[model samples]
Target: MSVTAITASTNSSSVRGSANATTNCLRLRRSHILFGTEKRYLSNQCVQNFRFTKPSNECGQRCIRVEAGWLFKGGGEQGSDARLERSESANEDILIFFYQLDLATRVQYALNLEEYDIAKQLRNKLNEVEAEVIKQREMKRGSSSKSEAQDKGISLLRLRADLQNAIENENYSLAAGIRDQISKLEADSLAATIKAQAFEKAEFEFRLGQKVRHKKFGYRAVVCGMDPVCCETSSWMENAHVDQLTRGADQPYYQVLVDVHEDPNLLVAYVPEENLLAPEEPDKAKFDHPYASFLFYGMDSAGDFIPVKQLREKYNRPRHEVPYDPQQDQTGDDNA
Candidate 1:
């Protein structure tokens, strides 16, 4: 036999092995996503353009590795396009597949684990995955008929999605710009609520020490406080930036030490009232915050937070003085 024939045969076997491995990985990833505790969404818009087969149990109830690069959609359903499609979407597929796996397999353990560093790494992975998912959806939207059909008219849905994505990705500069555009589009809505109002208004009624869920920031801690209070002096100001503090003066804000954050000790949020909502269940979730001890002396039988002795006394004492409203500071009042 010729040397070229032997070398070609060897390469063929290696390529077949690699293709099978990729298929198994894809199968495992699909199962993980389908049975996830908190299901991550898979958009039909993503898969609609492509034609693919379901995993077959005929393969010994084991993995059904589809033929090489069969999952990818190439233009026109023809020949060498197979090779080109693999090269094109390989990075995107790997990123998305691993991202789905992270959502399914890593999150529960990440939350349960006590080790700070490992949990943080897991959380950062989750954030990256979530950001990728949002970017993918946004890109899909941009390429759809809807974007083209708009003909320069504003799509508030797209704008809102982009704004939320920017905020979640910590793109503060971009968020600010998007926010300004949204305000302009919804100027009438803002004008309606622009009359006399309190510095902070609770969209949902809840007191301090209650458990609540934030639409963006997830579970635990409801720290209701005076608007624009000086948290820079407290441990609760760990992730608080000037932009976050000054961003939503017209809305109520909750001061919270978010549990299971990258830095549980320092990752506090002044979440806007609009973002706050009741937890899925009424049973209060026990959260451990480093500053909780300083703020609460102990929990009562019903698990309510109790203020420290000296702290409550200082506030309860009568002062023949008007209380300071930090929200007024925006109107050029500095005399706190």
Candidate 2:
């Protein structure tokens, strides 16, 4: 069982009627099973009950139970290891992202200071990070590169033809191998087709470069990319308590660039659709993520980030026009 230690103090009066009476102080430490992230804290009233009138040293340390019901709550006693492993994995992803952000920031600083040598080295590292991000995305989808529909169809047909020839030649072993390959190719093709349909239907709730806030964590972010459903590994899903979400892992997930001003530790977050909300008003303030300049052109009048051509192309997204605002135009004129 998951546990958290809490200490409470109890007071005792010895031989109350005697002149030489002395009071004894006893400290009690209790362990409670911490279930979910949302409600981990024990209340003051719960702590106060630990103060016993007849305090005993033997009872100083005891184990208690708490009914934890929140998002990502494990199923039972066996879930502890899964939860722990998941947490460690998340930490690794965050650390890697942090390193990339640091590199990008250093590259920008070097350029500003006219340190060409340092900037070149940092920029190279930043490029590595960019490539890694793309590779990781493809890995999640079980593909090395995005292939066109015609290419996939043609490949499948060629494999099937090879399988047929092998079978006709009485090459049983070769035919079996070809048959397995054909099955795998068909499965991949089907998955790709479904994903394409999802995109074509516009199933995503948020658009690329749109500003949003996390409903639970309340951090401001901009949508960078999205999946029809969570594409993270099983271990990552367990650690993130993705199963605990209202819509579960079957719902859309977004790749968001978090506002560094709000949370420097969290520069990027893969969040669920239900957890994101659009801002009621346009926020024209500067966003401080390192990837902001790399992935986007600039903020528009509506306070939304304008995605760069490359970023839009990567996600097959169309160009977005900045909403016209007379007040913004007037402000620009006044500044001029």
Best of the candidates, TM-score: 2
Which residue runs of candidate 1 sit more than 4 Å off their true CA positions? 1-204, 228-248, 261-266, 309-336
**Model 1, 256-336: lDDT tens per residue?**
544433223223455555556766544444666544665566564344566544323322322122246566565656553
Candidate 2 lDDT by residue in tens digits, 1-336: 111111221221110122321233323111122211111112321111111122233332233333332222222343332222222222233334444554555566667767676567547646755676667656454353235444677999999899889989999999999889888888877777665555445477888899998776666889887777677778778778887889997778888877766655454577889989998888777777766776778887788999877667666778988767798789999999
What is the Cα-based TM-score of model 2? 0.47
Question: Which pairs of residues clash in candidate 1, taking residues 3 or more apart in a chain or in different chains?
Answer: none
lDDT of each: 0.39, 0.58
Kindly give the number of clashing pairs for every candidate.
0, 0
Locate the minimum summed-lDDT window of 10 residues in model 1: 1-10
